[model samples]
Target: MRTKLSSTIFLAILACLLWASAFVGIKIGLPYTTPLQFAGIRFFISGLIILPFCSQRRDYFRLILKNWKVVFVITLLQTFVHYSLFYTGISMVPGALGAIVVGSGPVFVAIVAHFSMPDDKMSLKKAGVILLGLTGVVLVSLERGSLSGEGKLILVGIALLILTNINSGFTNIIVAKDKDKVPPLVLSSASMIVGGLMLFLFSIPIEGLHFSAKPFEYYAALAWLSFLSAAAFSIWFTLLKRPGVKVSDLNMWKFIIPVFGAIFAWILLPDEHPDVLSIAGMIITGSSLFLLNYLNRKKIVR
Candidate 1:
C-alpha cells in the first residue's frame, strides 16, 4: 500500500511538472498563432501522439464508440471548453499571472468534488490546507502588480480562467466516477482528437484562417506543447483511475504548477523575473503540499 501510494505521488508530481512547463510553451507559441488555433492544433496533435501507444490499437475506435458519451463530454469540457478559456485567458495576461490564476484550480476542484462525490467530501482541515496553498499562489501573483493599468482585459482573463477551473472540477469528477468505464489513454486520445478538431474548425470561422510562416521557435514550442499535453493528460487520467485516489486531494498537488510556472516564466521569458514575494510564495506552497500529504497519511482528512 505504501509503495503504491508513493508511486501515485511521484506520478502526480511528474504530471504537475509537465503541466507547469506548458505555460512557457503556450507563451512561446501564442506569439505566432491565434489562441484557439494554437490550442486546437496542439491538442489534435497530442491525441495523435497518444494513439499509437494505446494497448489495443486494433480496438481503439471500437472502444471510443462504446464509451462515446464519456468521450464526448470530456471532449467538450476538458479539451474544448477548458482550453478555449485557458488559451484565451493566458493570452490576455502574463505567463506568471496566468499560472497564478490557473493554480487556484484545486480550490475549485475541492469544492466541486465535495458536492459531487460523497467519498470526496470536504473537511475543514482539507479546506484550510487548500487555502494555505492559495495564499502562496496569491503571494506569487502579487509581484505582478495591480490590474489598474492592465484594465478589464486582465480581469476578464482571470474570470475566464476561474471558469475553466470550475469546468475542470466537474471534468475530473466525471473521469474519477467513470474510471472503470474506459481506459484513460483511449479516453484522452479520443476526447483530445474530437475536441481539438472542434476547436480547429471553429477557429477557421472565428479567428479567420490564419496560416502564415512562423519561425522555427514556433514549431518547437508547438511540438513541445503537444508532447507535454499528451504525456501529462495520460499520466493524470491514469492517476484518476487508481483506487483510493481522491479528486480533490490529487488536485492539491497541482498547486505546484504555479510555483514552477512562475519560476519558469522568470527564467525563460525576458520580460518576467522572480521577486522576493514569488520566492516566498513558492516556499509556502511547497510547505502546503507537505502538510497535505502528512494529513493524508495520518488519515486526518480526505
Candidate 2:
C-alpha cells in the first residue's frame, strides 16, 4: 500500500511537471510551426504511440465503439476545445504567466465539480481556499504589465487560458463520472487521435499546413513534447480513475505546475523573469496546497 501510494504521488507530480513544461515547449516550438498544426501533430503522434499499449482484447474495441458518444464528448472538450484554447493562448502569453493561469485550474475544477460530482461537493472552506488561490493568480497575472498594446494580446491570452481551465473542469467531471469498460489509456489515445486530426484539419485553412524548423531542435522538441503528452495523459487518466480519489485531491497537485513553469521560464526565456509580485503570488499560490483536504478545518460534515 505504501508503495502504491508513493507511486501514485510520483506519477501525479510527473504529470503536473510534464504539463507545466509544455508551456515552454509550446513557446519554443511555435516559431517553427503554427499553433493548431503544432498541437495537432503533437497529440496525433502521442495518440498513435500510446494506443497499442492500451490492450489487445477485441472487446476493448467494441467498448470504444459502444461508448463513442462519451468518447466524442471527451475528445471535443478534453483535447480539441481545451488544447485549441491552450495552444493559441500560450503562444501569445509568457510561459510563466501561461503556466500560472492554467495551473490555477484546480479552483475551477473544485467549483464545477461541486455542481457536477456528488462525491466532490464544495464547502465554505473550499470556497475560501479557492478565493485565496485566485487572489494569488490575479497577482501573478497583473505582474506581467498594463494591458495597453502587446499587453492586450496578453490579456486575451489570459482569458483564453481561463476558458481552457473551465473547459478542463467540465471535462474532468465528465471523465470522473464515466463508468465504461474501456481503459483510461485507450480513452486518452483514441480521443487524442480523433481530436488531433480535427485540429490539424482546422489548421490547414488558417495556417496552410506549413512546417519549418531547425533540423535537430524542431524534431527534438516535437518528440520530447509528444512523449510528455502521451505519458502525462496516460498517468493522469489512471489517477483520475483510481478508486477513492477525489478530483480536489488529484487536482491540488496542479499548483506544482506554476512552480515548474516559473523555474523553466526563468531559465529558458531570457526576457521573462519573476519580479516581486510574481514571487509573492507563487508563495501564496503554493501555500494553498496546505489549506485543503484534512488540513482545512471546517464545521460542515461531508
Candidate 3:
C-alpha cells in the first residue's frame, strides 16, 4: 500500500511537471503554429496514441453508447469549451500571466465543488486560504502590468479561462459520482476521441487542414502536449480513484506549475521578465495553496 501510494504521488508530480511545461511549450509553439491548428493536432495525436492502450474495446464502445449523454456533456464542457477558451486566452495574453490567472482554478474549483459535491464541502479555513491564493494571483497579475492598457483584453481572456476551470470542476464532480459505473480509462479515452474530433472540425475553417511548420521544437511541443493528453490524463484519472487523493489534495501542487511556467515563459519571451513583486506573489501563492492542502488533509485524516 505504501509502495502504491508512493508511486501515485510520483506520477501525480510527473503530471504536474508535464502540465506546467505545457504552458511554456504552447507559448513557444504558438509563434510557429496557429492556436486552433495546435489544439486540433494535439488532440488528434493524443487520441490516436491512447486508442491502442484502451482495454476491452467492446466494453469501451458499449459504455460510450450506454452513457452517451454524460460523455457528450463532459466532452463539450471539459474538452471542447475548456481548451478553446484556454488556447484562445493564451494566444491573446502573455503565457505567464495566463498561467497565473488560470492557476486560481483551484479556488474556483473549491467554490464550485462546495455547492455541487456534498463530499467536497468547503470550510472557512479553506475559504481563507483560497482568498489568500487569489490575492497572490491578483498581485502577480498586477505586477505583470496585466491590469493596464491592453490588459483589459487580458482580463476578458482570464475570465474565459476561469469559466473553463469551473466547468472542469463540475466535470470532476460528475466523474467522481459515476466513476464506479463507468471505467475512468474508457471515459477519458472517449472524451479525447470525441473532443479531438470536435476541435478538428472547428479548426477546419479557422486554421484549415494544413501543416506548415517543420521546426524540431514545434514538433517536439506538439508531441509533448499530445503525449500528456493521451497518457497523463489516464494516469491522473486512476490516481483520482485512489483513496485519500481528494481534489483539494491536487490543488497543493498546482502552484509549482505556474512557477515553472513563468520561468519557461520568461526564458522564451525575454520581454516578459518577472519583477520582484511577481516573485513574491508566486511565493505567497505557493504558501497559501500549501496551507489549504494541509488543512484539508488534516480534516480528511480526522
Please list the C-alpha lDDT of all candidates, in the order they appear. 0.89, 0.78, 0.72
Clash pairs, candidate 2, are none
Displacement of residue 282 (Cα, Å) in model 1 is 0.5
Tens-place lDDT per residue, model 3, 1-302, is: 44654576577767777777787677667788677767877877777787777786768788888889888887887678888987777666765467566877877777777787667777787778777777777666665554333657777787788777787777766766665655667777788778878987897898777766478988888888898787767776777666656665555455556665666667776677888877887788778856854675565467
Tell me the tens digit of each residue's lDDT in model 2 across 108-158.
888888878888887787777777766676566656545333658888898
Please give the range of 10 consecutive residues that has the lowest summed lDDT in model 2: 293-302
lDDT tens per residue, model 1, 86-125: 8788768765577677879999999999999999999899
Clashing pairs counted in every model: 0, 0, 0
lDDT (C-alpha) at residue 96 in model 2? 51
Question: How many angstroms is residue 226 displaced in model 2 relative to the true structure, after the best TM-score fit?
Answer: 0.5
Would you list the rank order by lDDT, best first?
Answer: 1, 2, 3
Judging by lDDT against the true structure, name the best candidate.
Answer: 1
* Candidate 3: stretches off by over 4 Å: 1-10, 92-97, 138-145, 151-155, 266-275
User: Which residue pairs in model 1 clash with each other?
Assistant: none
